[model samples]
Target: MRVVILFGSEMGTAETVADSVADALSAHDVSVYDMSDFAVDDLDVHDFHVIVCSTYGDGDLPTGAEPFFDELDACAPDLSGLRFAVFGLGDSIYGDTFNRGGEIAAEKLVARGAIQVGEHARHDASTEIRPKEMARDWAATLPVPALTSA
Candidate 1:
């Protein structure tokens, strides 16, 4: 399957995890892109998407993700044929919004008619386990083709 791994990071943990996820899925045709640089207008619904993003100050999306988010919101494309999954990096100590960035991004995608292929994965920065390792494991079990009939 062809997939796109996009990352939005502040301190780089999310970017590192995105790389780990991409590497783990090497069996598939995978392309990596920074959310800030990805051409959302050129996004193809035929490819699966894996979004790895970090929650920045006060549960907001990292700086790198803001432009993509704005472009998506403005364009509001009907992503009914798009397949996606989200992995969020956050510190649980931050309270209820621990992984709010990922949640928000996923919600927006779904709102635009994208088919979420798997459960959203939440990685805790406060944990002893490395985020990259966690992402590796998470990506391994993703039901990537669940929405093939969509």
Candidate 2:
């Protein structure tokens, strides 16, 4: 079983949370990618994907995430074989746009025919507790076949 943790962070919380998620997974193969370094072309290579992203200024995708989406749009790759899930980091003060970045990412993947494997997660930066721990717990609950031992 293999999994990929692809994250987009502005101030870096999402990356740290990615580490926690990787740590929590008992699977034998776990790969982590900073969105800045992730090649959108690689989407075809991984069948199981996890996205953790923070919404940036004015409810936008974080700096690291924009390129992937841009490339994905330009290429229009078929993603029906993929399975994915998302974790969103944002402050509720933004109201309707809160966590919009992750939502958009999820929407794009689904539109490309990827199967979503679990309930999506939205973490409020407003919360007193850090999102890392909660994110690990949330990711653990994904109905991902890759997370199970073969």
Candidate 3:
């Protein structure tokens, strides 16, 4: 089972958390990609995808992810056989649209036929909860697929 981890970060905190999650998932043979460096076309070949993104000003996607999100929305790839999970990092201080980017990404993925495996993980940096912990826990809960011999 090959899993693709896609992430977007603004101030590097989210990126750090994403890296930790990727490192953990690597033990299970999952591949990871920082959305900034990953091509949108690559998503079509993945069996499963994990999106880890941070919500920026006014619920906006990080600068590095804006173009990717635009292309994703335009192409709207069909992910019928894909299973996905979403982890959102944001500040509750934003109030009205806290973690909105992650929510939108998850919703869009669902609309494109991806099945959500578990509840969306929302982490608030402004609060006492640590985003890294939330990401690690979420990674552990994902069902590991049997290894196939190449």
Please name the candidate that would achieve the greatest lDDT relative to the true structure: 1
| Model 3 misplacement above 4 A | 146-150
lDDT of each: 0.88, 0.85, 0.78
Q: Which residue pairs collide in model 2, if any?
A: none
User: What lDDT tens digits, residue by residue, belong to model 3 across residues 10-67?
Assistant: 8876677777778767765567677878866777535667888899889988776677
Q: What is residue 150's positional error in candidate 3, in angstroms?
A: 12
Query: C-alpha displacement of 67 in model 1, angstroms?
Result: 0.2
TM-scores vs. true structure, each candidate: 0.94, 0.93, 0.87
Backbone N/Cα/C clashes per model: 0, 0, 0
Q: What ranking of all candidate models by TM-score puts the best one first? A: 1, 2, 3
Q: Which 10 residues in a row give candidate 3 its minimum summed lDDT?
A: 141-150
For model 1, the stretches where C-alpha displacement exceeds 4 angstroms are 146-150
**Residues 1-150 of candidate 1: C-alpha lDDT, one tens digit per residue:** 578999988888888999999988877788889999987776788888999999999999999999999999999888888889999999999999899999988998999999887778999978898898889999998877632444
Which pairs clash in model 3?
Answer: none
